[model samples]
Structures are given as structure tokens and as C-alpha cells.
Target: MLYLAGLAENSIVDGPGLRFTLFAQGCPHRCPGCQNPETWPFAGGQAAAPEQLVERIAQDPLVRGVTFSGGEPFAQAGEFARLGRLLRARGYEVACYTGYTFEQLFQNGNADQQALLHNLDVLVDGPFVQREQSLELAFRGSRNQRILDVPASLAAGRAVWVRARRWVLDEQPPEA
Candidate 1:
């Protein structure tokens, strides 16, 4: 069973390009200032089979890839690995967001989490640090977090940081 918070059919900011986003349920991190506080409890979301989610993602033709955001995808790592493998086999890239720092994950996640990490194209990791918050970071909320190139990290048996365009929240012109 998979605990899913929700799905965003098309999202541009979650990953490298336009993609479908799946927000999984259940996180233990409970980091302060988490934007999705509602997703903190494991019992708060709907449970579904992996095939159902895979089928839904497969049906979307316009999505270039899929982003698995969470309370923490590693919490449901087995499901993520299964779905990711299927998606990758179909030529779709998979990205994931996790609350664990790359080091922590490397040291503590279960076998399933490690497996899921292997299948992802990118991983945005680290618990949210409110004190270090930065709107300028791409795909992450704080300065301590990192955006990693997953396959490369796995191949090299270490984390490989990915460069992203800095988004300066202060510089954008006021929206009409």
C-alpha cells in the first residue's frame, strides 16, 4: 500500500522541466516551519496500490517526467522504487524530494530507500532549516539542503551536487 497526499498534473517548478508531481504521505522528520504541516502524520492520507499510481503517470502524455515530493518519499521507499523503475523503463526520468540529508540517508535509510535512491534521476535532500531559509535556492527551501544528481551519485558511490539557477526572490519585479 502506498500513502499518497495528492498529485499535481503538471508542474514546472518541482523539477528540471514540466512534470507530474506526486506528494507521498508520512514523514518522521517533522522539521520546524515545514510548508506542508498537514502531511506530517502517516495516517492522514489515502492509501493506494503502486500500479494505480503508475498507471496514472503513464497516461499523462504531456509530462516530461515525474517528481515525487513528500512528507518524505523515502518513508514509502519500496513503492517509490517500484514505480520509479517502471517509469524509467518507459523512458521517464524521476526526481524525488527527501527530508534526510544525503549523509543521513546514506547511513540510515532501509534497503528500500537505498533502492529508490538508486532509481532516481535527481534528489533534493536535507531537512528544512528555517534559520537557513532562502528563497534563492532552486527546488529546496534552505541553504543546507542539496540538489543531487542521483544516478551519478550512485555510480560514484557518493553525492554529486547539481547546479541550479539561483532564484532571487528579492529581485523579481512585482507581479501585476
Candidate 2:
């Protein structure tokens, strides 16, 4: 019984290139000024089978990957891990968004949470700090958040931030 808040198909902003984004339900970190406040309660979302979600994502040939965003995905870490493994086996890159900092997730998460983190290619971590909110930030709501390269960060035993400067291309080229 997976709790899914919603699904967005063909999303370019959620991850690198195009992606199928799943917004999971239930976040304990009810961080102030959260955009998706409706997703805060565990029971607010409808139950979905992992295979059903996977099938939906598989149908989209243009999708380069899948991004799991949420009311904190770590709350549903075990199910997310299962889904991530299945997606990875089908050659889909996985990304996730979480309220917990990388250090907190590493030190305090359950085995399933740890496994889920390991399966992801990229992770956008840290809770939204309203004071740090900046529209200029890439793929995150606040300055304190980070975009991590999961595999490299894990191997090096530290947080390795992936800068998103490449995606900010200028369309007009300043009239050159």
C-alpha cells in the first residue's frame, strides 16, 4: 500500500532532462511554509501499488528518469526502495527529494531509508528554510538545501553537491 500524493508526467524541472515525478504522502517534518501542505498527513493520499506506478512511468518513452518528491519520501522509504530497484532494473535513473539533511538521513534513518538513499542517483536534501527561500536556487526551495550526487557522496562518505549551472542556458544569447 503505497501512499501517493500525485504523479506528474513529462516533468523537466524535477530532474535532469525529462522525468516522471511521484509525490509521496506523509512527512513528519511539517516544515513551515511548505508548498504542498495537503500532503502532510499520512492518510491524506490514495493507496497505489508500486507496479502500477512503475507501469505508468514505463509507458513514457521520452522520460529519462523518475523523481520521487514528497512530503518527505523517507517516511515511505521501504516502499520507495522497492520501487527504485524495480525502476533501476528497467534502466531508469532515480532521484529523490527529502526534508532531512544528508547527515541526518545517514545517521538516523532505518535500514530501508538507508537502502533507498543508496538506490538514488541524485538527492535534493534539507528542509525548506523560509528565510533562505530563493527563486534563483536550482530545483530546491531554499539556499540551505543541496543537490547531491548520491553514489559519489556515498563512496566518499560525505555530501558531494552537484551544481546545476549547465541547465541554465540562455536562449537569446544576449543578441550576439
| TM-score to true structure, per model | 0.88, 0.90
Assess candidate 1 and give its lDDT: 0.81
Candidate 2 is scored at a TM of 0.90
Off by over 4 Å in 2: 163-176
Q: Kindly provide the TM-score of model 1 when superposed on the true structure, using C-alpha atoms.
A: 0.88
Residue-level lDDT for 40 in candidate 2:
90
Segments of candidate 1 deviating more than 4 angstroms: 163-176
Q: 93-145 in candidate 2: lDDT tens per residue?
A: 89999999888888788999999988888888899999999886657788777
Model 1 C-alpha lDDT per residue in residues 1-176, reported as the tens digit of each score: 77888889889888766788888988899999999887788996888787787788778787868999988899999988998988898888888999987777777878998889878988888899999998876677887777787877777777877543332222332221
lDDT of each: 0.81, 0.83
lDDT of 1 at 53: 77
Candidate with top lDDT is 2
Root-mean-square deviation (CA) per prediction: 5.4, 5.0
Task: Pull out the clashing pairs in model 2.
Answer: none
